[model samples]
Target: MITLKDVCFQYSADSTVKALRHIDLTIQDGECVVLTGESGCGKTTLTRCLNGLVPSFYEGELTGGLLLDEKNLLEMPQYEISRHVGTVFQDPRSQFFTVDSTDEVAFGCENLSMSTEKINQNIQKAFHNLRIEALKDCSLFALSSGERQKLAVAAIYAMDTPVLVLDEPSANLDLETMEVLRGILQELKREGKTIIVSEHRLSYLMGVADRYVYIQDGEIKQIWTPRQAEELSKAERKALGLRSFQSISLADIAKEGAPAEQGKRIEGRGLAVRLDKTEVFRGLTFNFQWGPAGKVVGITGNNGSGKTTFAKMLCGLLKPSEGALLFDGKPAAAKERLRQTYFVMQDTDYQLFTESVRHELELAERKNHRPCDMELILERMGLSQAAERHPLSLSGGQKQRVTIAAAMASGSDILVLDEPTSGLDGRNMQRLKETILALKKQGKLIFVVTHDMEFLDGIYDEVMSFAQKIR
Candidate 1:
C-alpha cells in the first residue's frame, strides 16, 4: 500500500509556483489509479514526488508524509526507492541509456546486481509479456517514438517491481499500440501490482483503470470509482476540463460541411525522396489545394512511412531526390518555399528559442517581416496569462501552444504542425481546433502530421495517407 498525508512541495522557497499542496491519497495493492487534470495543474509533479525524483534530483522544498508499503519514502534514498517503484517517463528517449533494445531492457536488472541467469530470464519474460520479440536487436536510436515507448515499458517490466508509475504513456503512440498498452496494464493488474498513471488521454484507460483522481490548482478536487466515472456525462466532463472516458471514432465526430472551392494549388510530379541509401517514397503524384478557404490536410501513416519526411520536403527543409513542386501553377524554388513555410516541430523545445511567449512572437515577426497583433493572438490561444512566463518554464502542452501561436503570427502561407495535440486535454484540443479553423479562414495552408484520430476527425477537412512501404 502507498499513502500520502498532507503532502506539499515547491520548486523554490521564493517561487510562486506551488507545484503541489495538502495532498492526501492512498492506493492499495493491485489498484490502478489514474491522475487527470489540465496542463500544469501538478499531475506530473505529484508523480515525481511518488517516484522520489522530487527532492532527490530536482532542487525543491518538500513537506509531506509519503509512505510506500508502510515505509516512509521521504527518508529513503532515490536509488533504494527506485527498486520498489519503477517509473516510465513521458518521453522514452530521455530514460534510455543503452544503444540496443535488449540491453536497455536489461539495464535495470543489472543495476540491482541480479544474477546473470535471473537477468536473462527477466528479459525474456518482459519481451514475451510485451509481445515485442521483433524489437530485441533493433537500435534504440533507429526505433520510432512509439517503438521506443514500448522499450521503455519493457525495461521497467524487467525490473519486476511491485509498483509502477507511467506518465503519459500513450501520448506518442498510434491506436494499435495504445490497445497493446491497455492490455499490458490489465495483465499487470491481475498480477497484484500497484499502477498509477498520469495522463491527459483518458479514453484508453476507461477499461483498465479502477479509480480516477482529478487534481486542480495543486489540490485534489475529485476522486471517483470506476462505476462513478462511467456515469459522467460528456458535458460534465467538458465542464471539468477532462477528456472523454468513452471511446469515440473519427467518423462519429467528422465535420459534415463541404470543402471550400477557392484556394491556392500545390502540385507534385514524380515525387521521390531518399535519405542516404534508404528510399522513403517514390513515384508520388498529387495536387493539394489550400488557402484561406481551404481544408486542413491530415497526413498519417505507420511509423517510418515518411509522413514527417514528406512534410519536411514540402516545407523546403529537405530537397526531394526527384520531383517538381508547383505553387499556384508556377514552379516554386526551395528558397521561395522556405520563405513561405512555417513548421511547428514534434518537439516544441527545439523551435522555441525566445525567453518569453510574447517575445517569441516578436522574433517570429521579425524573421517574416509580417505585422501581427501579438496580444490578440495570445488571447485566442488561451495563453494571454503566460505572456511573461519563460517558454521553458511552461508545461509541455503550453510550450506546444506557444509554438503554434508563433507560427500563426509569422504570416506564413504554409504551416505544418507535427503532433500538435500530443499532450493536450479535451478542452485544449477544442481551443486548437478553433485556432486551425480561424487560420483556414485567413487562407493559410495547414498540414497536420499526427496519429491522433480524434484530433484529425474534429478539425481536418482532407486526409492524405502515405501507405507506401519504405525500402
Candidate 2:
C-alpha cells in the first residue's frame, strides 16, 4: 500500500507555483488510481511525488510524509525507488534513451543490472504479452505516437515494477489505440500492479481506474469511485472542468463526410509521399476548400494510417514525391506553401524557443511580419496569467496553447495543428473550439490532425478520414 500523510512540496522556496500542498491519501495495494484535473492543477506533480521525483530529480522543498508499503519513500534514494516504481512520462520520447524499439523496452531492466539472459527473456515476454512484437527491432522514429506509447508500456512491463505510473499515455492516441492501452492497463491491474495514471482524457479510464482523485490548485478536492465518476452529470462535470467520462465516437463522421467536394479552392493532384523508402500515402486526391461547413477540416485516422503524413504535406513540412499542390486555383511551390503554412507540431516543445510566454508570441510575430494583438491572443487562450513565465516551465497543455497562439500570430493562411486537444481539459477544449471558430472567421484554412472525438464533435467543418484513404 502507498500512503501520503499530509504530503506537500514546492519547487523552490521563493517560487509561487503550487506544485502540491497537504496531499493526503492512501492507495491500496493493486489499486489503479487516476489523478485528474485542469491543466497545471498539480496532477503531474502528484505523480512525480509518488514516483519519488520530487526532491530527487526536480529541485524542490519537501514537507510531510510520503510512505510506500509503510516504508519512507521520501527518504529512499531515487535509484531504490526505481525497483518498485517505474514511470512512463507524457512524452514517451523524452524517456527513451535508445532508438531500437526492442532495446528501448529492455533499457529499464538493464539499468537494474539484471542478467543478459533474464533481460532477453523479459523482453520477449513483454513483447508477446503486450502484443507489440511487430514493433520489435523497429526504429522509434518510424513509429507513431501510439506505437511509441506501447513501446514505453512494454519497457515498464519488462521491468516488472510493483507500481506503474503513466503520465497521460492517451494524449496523442486515437480511440482504437487508446483501447489498446486500456487493455494493457486492465491486464496489469489483474496482475495486481499498483497503477497511477495522471490524465486529462478520462473516458478510457472508465473501467480501468479504481479511484479518481481530483486535484485543484495543489489540493486533493475529491476522491471518487468509478461509479461516481462515470455517473457524473454533464453540467457538474463542465462546472468542475472534467472531460466527459463516456467514450466519444467518430464512427458517424463517415456518413457526414461522404458528400462530394463543394469547391476547388485548395486541392492535391496525384499526391504521394515517401519517408525513407516507406510509402505513406499514394495517389491521394482531395479538394477540400471552403464549403457550407466552413474552413476547419479534421483529419481522422488510426495511428500509423498516414494522417500525420498528410498533415505534413498540407503544411509544407514534407514534399510530395509525386503530384502537385494548388492553392486558390494556382500551383503553389513548396517554398510558397512554407510561407503560407504554419504547423503546430504534436510535441510543442520542439517549436518553443523563447524564454517567456509573451516573448514566444513576439518572436512569432517578428518572423510573421504581421501586426497582432499579442495580449488579446494570450487572454483568449487563457494564458494571460502565464505570459511572463518561461514557455518550458508551463504544463504540457499550456505549452501547446502557446504554440497555437504563436501560430495565430504568424497570420498564416493554412494553420495545421497536430493533436491540439490531446492534453486539454474540457474547459480548455471549449476555449480552443472558440478560438478555432474565431480563426475560421478570419478565412484561415485550418487542418487539424486529431483523434479526439469530443474536439471533433465540436470543431470540424469537414472530416478527411486517412483511415479510408490510406487503407
Candidate 3:
C-alpha cells in the first residue's frame, strides 16, 4: 500500500544532517510490518514521510518519491493525502487537539465530512475494537497516558484508511491495554488492512507481524520473515539488543534488598485539591512507611483518582486544597522539597530540554558531586549509543529512560515517578525496577504511580489504589 524510492530527507533547519538517507521500501496490502531500531535511527522520520509529513508539517529537504497506493504523497498536500493514510503518533498529547475522548476520536472523520450517523457508527465500532468504551465521556486532559494512546489509535482506526502507520502505540499502555491493542491489530489484519508499527516492544507484536524490518542509520539493515525469525542465533539476538523470552528482570538486578513485608513510610492526611469548580479529591488519606530501604513501590489507581495531582503535591509542585504532606516528621515546603524528592512526570517529554542526554544529567546538579554512573545507567536503559544524540530524536522509550536516568542521577532522598514504565519493554522494566530497589537500599524513598501489574506484583512492597480508596 506504500512505497519509498531512494528517499533522502533532511530537516530544512539543518540541511547538512540527513534524517533519512537513500531509503527504499515497500509495504504490500494486508501486511503487518514492524520496524525496529535504536532511537534516532530515522524510524519516525520514515513513517512521517510515508503520509506526507516530510514536506508539509516538517519543513524538510526531500529528494525521492513516496507513494501511497497509486497517489504520490510528495505531490499531494497533507490534508489531501491524509484521507488515504492514517497515522497514530508516539505522543498522544501532540496528536490531540480536542477536549474530550469522543471528539478526539471523531475529529479525523469529521474533517473528512462523514455523516453524523456514520461517525457514530464508526465510533462505536472503534470503541468496541479498542476496548475503550468506558472512556467515551472522559476529557482528554483527564486521561492517563495509556488512555490517550488508545483513544488516538481508535481515532485513526475509525478513519478506515487504506494504510495505517502507528508510531510507538504502546508507549503509554499498561499490559491490559497493550493486549487490547494487539487484539485490535489482529482484527485489522483479518480485515485486510495494511499496518506499519514502529515500536521498541517486539515480543507482543512478534506473533502478528508478517515481517520484521530492522532500520539502522537511516537504512534498512535486514528484514526477517516469521519462519526465519525463530532460527535467529544468540549472537544475532544480542546484536539486535532485543532479549529472548526468558531473561532476568532489570529491576531485580537494581534492587538493594529482597522483597519484604510492607507498612508505612509516609502518610497522607485528609488530602484534597480544588481548581476552580473541580475538586480533584477531598478527604482522601493514605499511609506509606519506609520498609527495607531499597525496594520499589507501586502506586496504582483508576483514571482521575488524583495520582498525578497527588504526586505533584508530594513533590511540592501543587499545594493541596486541604491537607498536609509530611516527610520524615517535617512539613514539606518549596525550598525544603528539593532536598527530599524528585518526580518523573507521566509525560517525560515535559522534563527534557537539553541538547543531549549527557547535558541533561550534568544540568541536574545533584549534591555530593555524585550521580548515578551516567554511562552505565544509560547502557542499562538501552540509551548508551544515543547518549550524544538529541533527546528529541530518540524513541518514546528512549526519552522515558533518559528522564529516569536523570531522576536516578539526582542525589535526593525520595523519587516519585508517575508511569515511568509507560513505553518500556519487559527488559527495560526490569532494569528500572532494579534501579529503584538499589535506591531503596540507600535509604531513599521510592514512589511509583503505575498500572503495570507485572512490575508491581513482585516488586512493590505495598500496592495502593487511589480511585478506590481516595473517597
Model-by-model lDDT, in order? 0.85, 0.86, 0.75
Q: Identify the leading candidate in terms of lDDT.
A: 2
What stretches of model 1 exceed 4 Å from their correct place? 251-262, 331-333, 467-471
Residue pairs clashing in model 2 are: none
After TM-score superposition, what is the CA distance of residue 376 in candidate 2 from its true location, in Å?
1.7
lDDT string, candidate 1, 1-471, tens digits:
999999988886328888899999999999999999888888888998999998887668889799998899989987899889999997788799999999999999999889999999999998988878878977876666667888999999999899999998988776666788899999999999999999988888987998899999899999998889889987888887787776665456565645556658988999998877667889878888765575688887655678888888988888999989889889888887888899888767788898799999998887689899998999988899899888988877788899999998899878999888877877888788889988888877799998787777767777777765341
Give, for candidate 3, the lowest lDDT window spanning 10 residues: 244-253
Q: Please identify which of the two predictions, 2 or 3, would achieve the higher TM-score against the true structure.
A: 2
Poorly placed runs, candidate 2 (over 4 Å)? 252-264, 291-294, 468-471
Clashes of each: 2, 0, 16
Q: Per-residue error at 262 for model 3, in Å?
A: 12
Q: Over the stretch 1-471, how does candidate 2's per-residue lDDT look in tens digits?
A: 999998877886328875888999999989999999999898888888989878777878889998899999988988899999999998888899998998898899999999999999999988987777778998888887777877888899999999999999889777876887898889899999999999989989988899999999899999999998988998989888889888878864444543543653788899999988788888888887674444888888887889888877876778999998898779888777788889888888899998899999998887669899988999999999999998888888899899999999888777999999877988898889899988987777788899998887756778878774222
> lDDT score, residue 309, model 1?
82
318 Cα displacement, candidate 2 (Å) = 1.3
In model 2, how large is the Cα lDDT of residue 127?
Answer: 91
Which of 2 and 3 is the better model by lDDT?
2
As a whole number from 0 to 100, the lDDT of residue 60 in candidate 1 is: 84
